[model samples]
Target: MSDPTRFIPVPTPETAHFWEGARAGELRLQRCADCRKAYFPPRAFCPECGSREVRVERASGRARLYSYVINHLPAPGFTAPYAIAVVELEEGPRMMSNILDCPQTPEALVLDMPLEVTFERLSDEISLPQFRPAKGRAA
Candidate 1:
């Protein structure tokens, strides 16, 4: 039997810092040195200002549930009834990730609710950044 957790990410030079930070238990993002705009999915230049001057920075690990769907379809490495969510980070960038530590339902996964980043080690070199209900929020 194959392990679903075997799914691993291959990091490119532009996104290496992000994958490294996740393995070290931190959420890393890039900020434009000129516009000071933070962004994700690691690009060589700033998406907002089209500047090549960008640097990696640690994020606050806080986010809000922007949108999501409860996926009930079967896949290679995922179970049915999983919540695939788009979360807006505190740094103003949005990321797509799986919502963890909560039931995959509308009543439990409230929109605009607070979320906290949690890393799941998928392999030796990859740790996916997932989110869970923030402390004191209804699950």
Candidate 2:
């Protein structure tokens, strides 16, 4: 198995701002100035209208649990039974992240549960955007 600890992302020029924002504890996304449509996996132009007038904006850090899977198999840099989830951001974008600070169980991970973004710094220059149960949710 590949070393998960070595699975660092190499940012391209198009995605540099997004990675930079994560390291700085902010969630950044791209919005097309033409269509006002926000999207992820940052690109040079808007995926909706093919407009180059895209701008970087900070996300609200709020999300809803869309779907998830509990991985029981051991992998590099991961413990068994970790929750890998797809979270729908408040701005209408969905991102895949690990659900932290909560048990990785079906009874604990409910669909549509509220979540908030938290950064996990991997290195001096790399920080991963992770999600955790929102404040006030049952523990």
lDDT computed for candidate 1 = 0.91
My TM-score estimates for the predictions, one after another, are 0.94, 0.94
The residue-by-residue lDDT of candidate 1 on 1-139, one tens digit each, is: 3355456779999889899999999999999999999998898999999999999999999999999999988867787888889999999999999999898889999999999999988877888899999988847
Residue 58 alpha-carbon offset, candidate 1, angstroms? 0.3
Ten residues in sequence with the least summed lDDT for candidate 2? 1-10
**lDDT against the true structure, each candidate:** 0.91, 0.91
CA displacement after TM-score superposition, residue 132 of candidate 2 (Å): 0.4
